[model samples]
Target: MSVLLEFTIRSDQFKLGHVLSGSGDMRFELERIVPTGGHTMPFVWVSTERDPNEDLPRFEANMRESDSVQELLALDRVDDGGLYRIEWEGQPEGLIKGLAEAEATVLEAFGDRNWTFRVRFMDHERLTNFHNYLTDHDISVHIIRTYTFTEEGARRRDFGLTNEQREALVLALQRGYFDTPSEVTLDELAEELGITKQAISDRIRRGNEKMLRPLLLSSAAR
Candidate 1:
Protein backbone atom coordinates (compact mmCIF):
# COMPACT_ATOMS: atom_id res chain seq x y z
CA MET A 1 0.00 0.00 0.00
CA SER A 2 1.24 3.46 -0.82
CA VAL A 3 1.60 5.93 2.05
CA LEU A 4 1.83 9.72 2.20
CA LEU A 5 4.13 11.48 4.64
CA GLU A 6 4.31 15.16 5.50
CA PHE A 7 7.36 16.57 7.25
CA THR A 8 9.29 19.82 7.73
CA ILE A 9 12.96 20.77 7.31
CA ARG A 10 14.83 23.90 8.36
CA SER A 11 15.51 26.13 5.35
CA ASP A 12 19.24 26.34 6.11
CA GLN A 13 19.66 22.59 5.72
CA PHE A 14 18.27 22.46 2.17
CA LYS A 15 18.58 24.14 -1.21
CA LEU A 16 18.13 27.92 -1.58
CA GLY A 17 19.02 28.25 2.10
CA HIS A 18 21.67 30.85 1.50
CA VAL A 19 19.40 32.95 -0.71
CA LEU A 20 16.76 32.96 2.02
CA SER A 21 17.84 33.79 5.54
CA GLY A 22 16.35 34.68 8.95
CA SER A 23 12.84 33.62 7.85
CA GLY A 24 12.15 36.72 5.81
CA ASP A 25 8.85 37.00 3.89
CA MET A 26 10.02 35.01 0.87
CA ARG A 27 9.00 31.73 -0.73
CA PHE A 28 10.69 29.19 -3.02
CA GLU A 29 8.32 27.16 -5.11
CA LEU A 30 9.85 24.18 -6.96
CA GLU A 31 8.86 24.52 -10.61
CA ARG A 32 10.69 21.79 -12.51
CA ILE A 33 13.69 19.51 -12.36
CA VAL A 34 16.29 18.63 -15.00
CA PRO A 35 18.83 15.92 -14.37
CA THR A 36 22.35 17.05 -15.23
CA GLY A 37 25.66 15.18 -15.33
CA GLY A 38 25.88 14.14 -11.69
CA HIS A 39 23.74 16.94 -10.26
CA THR A 40 20.12 18.02 -10.51
CA MET A 41 19.14 21.41 -11.86
CA PRO A 42 16.01 22.64 -10.13
CA PHE A 43 14.09 25.51 -11.65
CA VAL A 44 12.52 27.41 -8.79
CA TRP A 45 10.05 30.24 -8.61
CA VAL A 46 11.01 32.69 -5.88
CA SER A 47 8.70 35.41 -4.57
CA THR A 48 9.29 38.06 -1.96
CA GLU A 49 7.29 40.65 -0.08
CA ARG A 50 9.96 43.22 -0.83
CA ASP A 51 11.23 44.70 -4.11
CA PRO A 52 12.48 42.06 -6.56
CA ASN A 53 14.77 44.43 -8.48
CA GLU A 54 16.77 45.03 -5.33
CA ASP A 55 16.55 41.57 -3.80
CA LEU A 56 17.06 39.14 -6.71
CA PRO A 57 20.71 40.09 -7.25
CA ARG A 58 21.39 39.40 -3.62
CA PHE A 59 19.61 36.07 -3.94
CA GLU A 60 21.64 35.10 -7.02
CA ALA A 61 24.87 36.05 -5.31
CA ASN A 62 23.93 34.14 -2.19
CA MET A 63 23.15 31.03 -4.25
CA ARG A 64 26.61 31.18 -5.77
CA GLU A 65 28.12 31.26 -2.29
CA SER A 66 25.95 28.61 -0.61
CA ASP A 67 27.78 25.33 0.00
CA SER A 68 24.77 23.26 -1.03
CA VAL A 69 24.43 25.15 -4.31
CA GLN A 70 26.88 23.76 -6.86
CA GLU A 71 26.25 26.32 -9.59
CA LEU A 72 23.99 29.30 -10.12
CA LEU A 73 23.23 28.90 -13.79
CA ALA A 74 20.38 31.20 -14.67
CA LEU A 75 18.17 33.80 -13.03
CA ASP A 76 15.29 35.28 -14.95
CA ARG A 77 12.59 37.75 -13.99
CA VAL A 78 9.12 36.65 -14.98
CA ASP A 79 6.69 39.44 -14.18
CA ASP A 80 6.68 39.57 -10.37
CA GLY A 81 8.41 36.20 -10.02
CA GLY A 82 12.09 35.26 -9.95
CA LEU A 83 12.96 32.08 -11.79
CA TYR A 84 16.18 30.21 -11.03
CA ARG A 85 18.02 27.21 -12.44
CA ILE A 86 20.51 25.94 -9.89
CA GLU A 87 22.92 23.00 -9.93
CA TRP A 88 22.46 21.69 -6.44
CA GLU A 89 25.34 19.96 -4.65
CA GLY A 90 23.76 16.83 -3.24
CA GLN A 91 23.26 16.96 0.53
CA PRO A 92 23.35 13.55 2.20
CA GLU A 93 21.27 14.89 5.06
CA GLY A 94 18.60 16.23 2.69
CA LEU A 95 15.18 14.73 2.03
CA ILE A 96 16.03 13.69 -1.54
CA LYS A 97 18.89 11.48 -0.40
CA GLY A 98 16.82 9.74 2.23
CA LEU A 99 13.88 9.33 -0.14
CA ALA A 100 16.15 7.90 -2.85
CA GLU A 101 17.73 5.52 -0.38
CA ALA A 102 14.29 4.36 0.67
CA GLU A 103 13.02 4.26 -2.94
CA ALA A 104 10.27 6.76 -2.17
CA THR A 105 8.73 9.35 -4.49
CA VAL A 106 8.54 13.02 -3.58
CA LEU A 107 5.07 14.39 -4.25
CA GLU A 108 5.08 17.98 -3.08
CA ALA A 109 7.80 20.20 -1.62
CA PHE A 110 7.30 23.91 -0.85
CA GLY A 111 7.69 26.41 2.03
CA ASP A 112 9.67 29.51 3.00
CA ARG A 113 10.55 29.65 6.70
CA ASN A 114 10.87 25.91 6.51
CA TRP A 115 10.05 23.43 3.75
CA THR A 116 7.18 20.98 4.10
CA PHE A 117 7.45 17.95 1.81
CA ARG A 118 4.87 15.33 0.94
CA VAL A 119 6.58 12.06 0.11
CA ARG A 120 5.09 8.77 -0.98
CA PHE A 121 6.47 5.41 0.01
CA MET A 122 5.57 2.05 -1.48
CA ASP A 123 5.14 0.58 2.00
CA HIS A 124 5.52 1.23 5.68
CA GLU A 125 8.94 -0.39 5.66
CA ARG A 126 10.28 2.13 3.15
CA LEU A 127 8.88 4.94 5.27
CA THR A 128 10.60 3.53 8.33
CA ASN A 129 13.86 3.22 6.44
CA PHE A 130 13.60 6.84 5.28
CA HIS A 131 13.08 8.03 8.84
CA ASN A 132 16.03 6.00 10.10
CA TYR A 133 18.32 7.31 7.37
CA LEU A 134 17.55 10.91 8.26
CA THR A 135 18.01 10.30 11.98
CA ASP A 136 21.28 8.47 11.40
CA HIS A 137 22.61 11.59 9.69
CA ASP A 138 21.69 13.62 12.79
CA ILE A 139 18.97 15.40 10.86
CA SER A 140 15.95 16.16 13.04
CA VAL A 141 12.91 14.75 11.28
CA HIS A 142 9.52 16.20 12.10
CA ILE A 143 6.72 13.89 11.07
CA ILE A 144 3.39 15.63 10.68
CA ARG A 145 1.15 12.74 9.67
CA THR A 146 1.12 9.52 7.69
CA TYR A 147 -1.84 7.95 5.95
CA THR A 148 -2.76 5.40 3.32
CA PHE A 149 -3.39 6.74 -0.17
CA THR A 150 -6.69 6.16 -1.90
CA GLU A 151 -6.70 5.47 -5.64
CA GLU A 152 -9.00 8.40 -6.39
CA GLY A 153 -6.99 10.76 -4.20
CA ALA A 154 -3.73 9.61 -5.80
CA ARG A 155 -4.98 10.67 -9.27
CA ARG A 156 -5.74 14.16 -8.02
CA ARG A 157 -2.30 14.39 -6.39
CA ASP A 158 -0.25 14.24 -9.63
CA PHE A 159 0.04 18.03 -9.46
CA GLY A 160 1.60 17.83 -6.00
CA LEU A 161 -1.09 19.35 -3.79
CA THR A 162 -0.57 18.78 -0.09
CA ASN A 163 -3.26 17.14 2.04
CA GLU A 164 -4.60 20.48 3.29
CA GLN A 165 -4.81 21.78 -0.29
CA ARG A 166 -6.53 18.61 -1.48
CA GLU A 167 -9.13 18.81 1.29
CA ALA A 168 -9.85 22.46 0.56
CA LEU A 169 -10.23 21.82 -3.18
CA VAL A 170 -12.57 18.87 -2.70
CA LEU A 171 -14.65 20.71 -0.15
CA ALA A 172 -14.96 23.75 -2.38
CA LEU A 173 -16.04 21.64 -5.35
CA GLN A 174 -18.57 19.68 -3.32
CA ARG A 175 -20.01 22.88 -1.91
CA GLY A 176 -20.46 24.37 -5.41
CA TYR A 177 -17.93 27.04 -4.61
CA PHE A 178 -16.69 26.98 -8.21
CA ASP A 179 -20.11 27.01 -9.82
CA THR A 180 -21.33 29.82 -12.05
CA PRO A 181 -23.61 30.90 -9.23
CA SER A 182 -21.20 30.33 -6.40
CA GLU A 183 -22.66 28.47 -3.44
CA VAL A 184 -20.00 29.42 -0.90
CA THR A 185 -17.95 32.52 -0.19
CA LEU A 186 -14.34 32.54 0.93
CA ASP A 187 -15.39 33.50 4.42
CA GLU A 188 -17.96 30.69 4.48
CA LEU A 189 -15.35 28.13 3.34
CA ALA A 190 -12.93 29.46 5.94
CA GLU A 191 -15.51 29.03 8.70
CA GLU A 192 -16.34 25.55 7.48
CA LEU A 193 -12.67 24.53 7.59
CA GLY A 194 -11.85 26.41 10.83
CA ILE A 195 -9.19 28.45 9.09
CA THR A 196 -8.85 32.13 8.16
CA LYS A 197 -10.17 33.43 4.83
CA GLN A 198 -6.67 34.20 3.57
CA ALA A 199 -5.57 30.74 4.54
CA ILE A 200 -8.33 29.11 2.49
CA SER A 201 -7.60 31.36 -0.48
CA ASP A 202 -3.92 30.50 -0.39
CA ARG A 203 -4.65 26.81 -0.21
CA ILE A 204 -6.99 26.97 -3.18
CA ARG A 205 -4.46 28.91 -5.24
CA ARG A 206 -1.62 26.53 -4.48
CA GLY A 207 -3.84 23.51 -5.05
CA ASN A 208 -5.00 24.83 -8.41
CA GLU A 209 -1.42 25.45 -9.49
CA LYS A 210 -0.39 21.94 -8.51
CA MET A 211 -3.38 20.41 -10.28
CA LEU A 212 -2.86 22.35 -13.53
CA ARG A 213 0.92 22.30 -13.90
CA PRO A 214 0.99 18.77 -15.26
CA LEU A 215 -1.63 19.51 -17.89
CA LEU A 216 0.30 22.54 -19.05
CA LEU A 217 3.52 20.55 -19.27
CA SER A 218 1.92 17.83 -21.37
CA SER A 219 0.39 20.36 -23.70
CA ALA A 220 3.74 22.00 -24.24
CA ALA A 221 5.41 18.68 -24.88
CA ARG A 222 2.94 17.79 -27.63
Candidate 2:
Protein backbone atom coordinates (compact mmCIF):
# COMPACT_ATOMS: atom_id res chain seq x y z
CA MET A 1 0.00 0.00 0.00
CA SER A 2 1.41 3.39 -0.97
CA VAL A 3 0.25 7.00 -0.59
CA LEU A 4 1.99 10.29 -1.38
CA LEU A 5 1.34 14.03 -1.71
CA GLU A 6 3.57 16.25 -3.89
CA PHE A 7 3.44 19.90 -4.92
CA THR A 8 5.68 22.90 -5.54
CA ILE A 9 6.18 25.78 -3.10
CA ARG A 10 8.19 28.85 -4.14
CA SER A 11 8.05 30.49 -0.74
CA ASP A 12 8.24 29.49 2.95
CA GLN A 13 4.72 28.81 4.22
CA PHE A 14 2.35 26.01 5.27
CA LYS A 15 -1.22 24.70 4.53
CA LEU A 16 -2.22 26.82 1.54
CA GLY A 17 1.38 26.76 0.27
CA HIS A 18 3.90 23.94 -0.21
CA VAL A 19 6.07 22.87 2.74
CA LEU A 20 9.76 22.14 2.03
CA SER A 21 12.00 20.90 4.85
CA GLY A 22 14.64 18.28 4.04
CA SER A 23 18.41 17.91 3.85
CA GLY A 24 21.24 16.92 1.44
CA ASP A 25 21.35 14.71 -1.68
CA MET A 26 18.95 11.94 -2.70
CA ARG A 27 18.28 9.38 -5.45
CA PHE A 28 14.68 8.76 -6.55
CA GLU A 29 12.94 7.23 -9.54
CA LEU A 30 11.00 9.79 -11.55
CA GLU A 31 7.87 8.52 -13.30
CA ARG A 32 6.77 11.45 -15.38
CA ILE A 33 3.15 12.41 -14.97
CA VAL A 34 0.73 14.35 -17.13
CA PRO A 35 -1.44 16.42 -14.82
CA THR A 36 -5.16 16.09 -15.46
CA GLY A 37 -6.04 18.98 -13.16
CA GLY A 38 -7.87 19.04 -9.78
CA HIS A 39 -5.64 17.23 -7.24
CA THR A 40 -4.33 15.12 -10.08
CA MET A 41 -0.65 15.76 -10.76
CA PRO A 42 2.07 13.55 -12.17
CA PHE A 43 4.15 12.00 -9.36
CA VAL A 44 5.29 8.68 -7.91
CA TRP A 45 4.58 7.47 -4.38
CA VAL A 46 5.02 4.21 -2.44
CA SER A 47 4.15 2.99 1.07
CA THR A 48 5.33 0.24 3.48
CA GLU A 49 4.66 -1.02 7.04
CA ARG A 50 8.20 -1.26 8.37
CA ASP A 51 9.20 0.79 11.39
CA PRO A 52 10.65 4.05 10.13
CA ASN A 53 12.93 3.73 13.17
CA GLU A 54 13.50 0.02 12.54
CA ASP A 55 11.51 -1.01 15.62
CA LEU A 56 8.22 -2.95 15.82
CA PRO A 57 6.79 -1.08 18.77
CA ARG A 58 7.41 2.23 17.08
CA PHE A 59 6.01 0.99 13.78
CA GLU A 60 2.95 -0.32 15.57
CA ALA A 61 2.32 2.99 17.25
CA ASN A 62 2.56 4.87 13.98
CA MET A 63 0.15 2.44 12.33
CA ARG A 64 -2.56 3.56 14.72
CA GLU A 65 -2.48 7.02 13.21
CA SER A 66 -1.21 8.33 9.86
CA ASP A 67 -3.75 8.25 7.04
CA SER A 68 -1.19 7.33 4.36
CA VAL A 69 -0.57 4.08 6.26
CA GLN A 70 -4.15 2.91 5.62
CA GLU A 71 -3.09 0.79 2.64
CA LEU A 72 -0.10 -1.08 4.13
CA LEU A 73 -1.72 -2.22 7.38
CA ALA A 74 -4.99 -2.96 5.64
CA LEU A 75 -3.26 -5.16 3.05
CA ASP A 76 -1.79 -7.90 5.32
CA ARG A 77 -4.64 -8.64 7.69
CA VAL A 78 -3.32 -6.36 10.42
CA ASP A 79 -4.91 -7.35 13.74
CA ASP A 80 -6.29 -4.52 15.80
CA GLY A 81 -6.08 -2.71 12.54
CA GLY A 82 -6.88 0.94 13.10
CA LEU A 83 -9.65 3.03 11.56
CA TYR A 84 -9.08 6.33 9.73
CA ARG A 85 -10.90 8.64 7.33
CA ILE A 86 -10.18 10.58 4.16
CA GLU A 87 -11.56 14.09 4.02
CA TRP A 88 -11.58 16.75 1.33
CA GLU A 89 -13.13 20.03 2.27
CA GLY A 90 -13.60 22.69 -0.34
CA GLN A 91 -11.03 25.49 -0.04
CA PRO A 92 -11.64 29.21 -0.54
CA GLU A 93 -11.07 30.33 -4.13
CA GLY A 94 -8.29 32.83 -3.40
CA LEU A 95 -5.97 30.36 -1.59
CA ILE A 96 -6.33 27.74 -4.31
CA LYS A 97 -5.44 30.18 -7.09
CA GLY A 98 -2.40 31.50 -5.23
CA LEU A 99 -0.68 28.07 -5.01
CA ALA A 100 -1.31 27.36 -8.68
CA GLU A 101 1.00 30.27 -9.51
CA ALA A 102 3.94 29.68 -7.15
CA GLU A 103 7.25 30.64 -8.79
CA ALA A 104 9.25 27.60 -7.64
CA THR A 105 7.05 25.10 -9.49
CA VAL A 106 9.52 25.09 -12.41
CA LEU A 107 11.88 22.57 -10.74
CA GLU A 108 12.57 19.22 -12.40
CA ALA A 109 12.34 17.29 -9.13
CA PHE A 110 12.74 17.27 -5.34
CA GLY A 111 16.16 18.75 -4.57
CA ASP A 112 18.54 19.57 -1.71
CA ARG A 113 18.76 23.22 -2.72
CA ASN A 114 15.05 23.55 -3.42
CA TRP A 115 13.37 26.16 -1.25
CA THR A 116 11.49 23.22 0.40
CA PHE A 117 10.91 19.50 -0.08
CA ARG A 118 9.19 17.90 2.87
CA VAL A 119 7.44 14.54 2.95
CA ARG A 120 6.39 12.33 5.83
CA PHE A 121 4.55 9.12 6.72
CA MET A 122 2.83 8.29 9.97
CA ASP A 123 5.42 8.05 12.78
CA HIS A 124 4.52 6.30 16.04
CA GLU A 125 6.21 6.18 19.44
CA ARG A 126 6.73 2.41 19.37
CA LEU A 127 8.76 2.89 16.21
CA THR A 128 10.47 5.80 17.93
CA ASN A 129 11.30 3.41 20.78
CA PHE A 130 12.98 1.05 18.31
CA HIS A 131 15.03 3.87 16.83
CA ASN A 132 16.06 4.90 20.30
CA TYR A 133 17.14 1.30 20.90
CA LEU A 134 19.48 0.91 17.91
CA THR A 135 21.21 4.20 18.66
CA ASP A 136 21.97 3.24 22.26
CA HIS A 137 23.86 0.00 21.51
CA ASP A 138 26.28 1.23 18.84
CA ILE A 139 25.30 -1.64 16.55
CA SER A 140 25.47 -1.30 12.78
CA VAL A 141 22.72 -3.89 12.56
CA HIS A 142 22.68 -4.34 8.82
CA ILE A 143 19.54 -5.05 6.85
CA ILE A 144 18.01 -8.48 7.46
CA ARG A 145 14.40 -9.63 6.98
CA THR A 146 13.26 -11.76 9.91
CA TYR A 147 10.36 -12.42 12.31
CA THR A 148 10.85 -11.54 15.99
CA PHE A 149 8.68 -11.28 19.11
CA THR A 150 8.55 -8.61 21.76
CA GLU A 151 6.48 -9.14 24.91
CA GLU A 152 3.86 -7.01 23.10
CA GLY A 153 2.14 -7.48 19.68
CA ALA A 154 -0.70 -9.56 18.19
CA ARG A 155 -0.58 -13.01 16.55
CA ARG A 156 1.80 -13.86 13.73
CA ARG A 157 3.24 -10.41 14.33
CA ASP A 158 4.97 -10.59 10.97
CA PHE A 159 4.83 -8.51 7.79
CA GLY A 160 6.81 -6.81 5.01
CA LEU A 161 8.82 -3.60 4.76
CA THR A 162 9.85 -1.78 1.57
CA ASN A 163 13.55 -2.75 2.11
CA GLU A 164 14.72 -0.25 4.69
CA GLN A 165 16.37 -1.45 7.90
CA ARG A 166 15.79 1.59 10.08
CA GLU A 167 14.74 5.20 9.82
CA ALA A 168 18.42 6.01 10.27
CA LEU A 169 19.06 4.28 6.96
CA VAL A 170 16.90 6.88 5.23
CA LEU A 171 18.41 9.69 7.30
CA ALA A 172 21.92 8.44 6.60
CA LEU A 173 21.32 8.10 2.90
CA GLN A 174 19.53 11.47 2.62
CA ARG A 175 21.87 13.28 5.05
CA GLY A 176 18.89 14.32 7.19
CA TYR A 177 20.45 13.88 10.67
CA PHE A 178 24.09 13.53 9.77
CA ASP A 179 26.34 16.39 8.74
CA THR A 180 29.57 14.47 8.12
CA PRO A 181 30.72 11.24 6.44
CA SER A 182 30.98 9.52 9.83
CA GLU A 183 27.87 7.49 10.73
CA VAL A 184 25.99 8.30 13.91
CA THR A 185 27.21 5.73 16.47
CA LEU A 186 24.46 3.58 18.03
CA ASP A 187 25.57 4.25 21.62
CA GLU A 188 25.56 7.99 21.06
CA LEU A 189 22.17 7.90 19.37
CA ALA A 190 20.67 5.86 22.22
CA GLU A 191 22.11 8.21 24.83
CA GLU A 192 20.75 11.22 23.00
CA LEU A 193 17.36 9.53 22.67
CA GLY A 194 17.51 8.13 26.25
CA ILE A 195 16.82 4.41 25.84
CA THR A 196 18.62 1.24 26.97
CA LYS A 197 21.01 -0.55 24.62
CA GLN A 198 19.20 -3.89 24.94
CA ALA A 199 15.84 -2.29 24.30
CA ILE A 200 17.13 -0.72 21.12
CA SER A 201 18.62 -4.04 20.03
CA ASP A 202 15.35 -5.82 20.66
CA ARG A 203 13.36 -3.23 18.72
CA ILE A 204 15.77 -3.41 15.79
CA ARG A 205 15.60 -7.21 15.80
CA ARG A 206 11.82 -7.21 15.91
CA GLY A 207 11.71 -4.51 13.27
CA ASN A 208 13.64 -6.83 10.98
CA GLU A 209 10.85 -9.40 11.11
CA LYS A 210 8.16 -6.82 10.41
CA MET A 211 9.64 -5.64 7.09
CA LEU A 212 13.27 -4.68 7.55
CA ARG A 213 15.04 -8.03 7.51
CA PRO A 214 16.64 -6.78 4.35
CA LEU A 215 18.19 -4.00 6.41
CA LEU A 216 20.40 -5.49 9.16
CA LEU A 217 20.85 -9.14 8.12
CA SER A 218 19.39 -12.01 6.10
CA SER A 219 15.66 -12.70 6.34
CA ALA A 220 16.49 -15.93 8.19
CA ALA A 221 18.53 -14.03 10.78
CA ARG A 222 15.50 -12.07 11.95
Backbone clash count for every predicted candidate, in the order shown: 0, 29
lDDT of 1 at 152: 32
**What is candidate 2's lDDT per residue for 1-222, written digit by digit as tens?**
111123333322322122112211211211222222443222321122233233333434443344322222221212211212211123222222222322112212322223223222123333334334435533222322212233112322433222333543343345433456556655554464465444333334434554543444554686
Reference-based lDDT, residue 41, model 2:
29
Write down the RMSD of candidate 2 (Cα, Å): 19.6
After TM-score superposition, the amount by which residue 157's alpha carbon in candidate 1 deviates from its true location, in angstroms, is 9.7
Model 1 CA deviation exceeding 4 Å by range: 13-19, 22-24, 32-40, 75-77, 89-93, 151-207, 213-222
Candidate 2 Cα outliers beyond 4 Å, as residue runs:
1-12, 16-35, 40-99, 102-222
Candidate 2: Cα lDDT at 100: 33
- What digit string (tens of lDDT, one per residue) describes model 1 on residues 1-222? 988898888876654543456335667776655554645566777765456666677777777777767777656764344677877667433655566668776666677867877778999999889888877777765788888888536665456567888899999999999999999998899899997675677678778877777778758999
Candidate 1, residue 196: the lDDT equals: 68
Q: Candidate 2, which ten residues in sequence have the lowest lDDT sum?
A: 19-28
lDDT of 2 at 45: 19
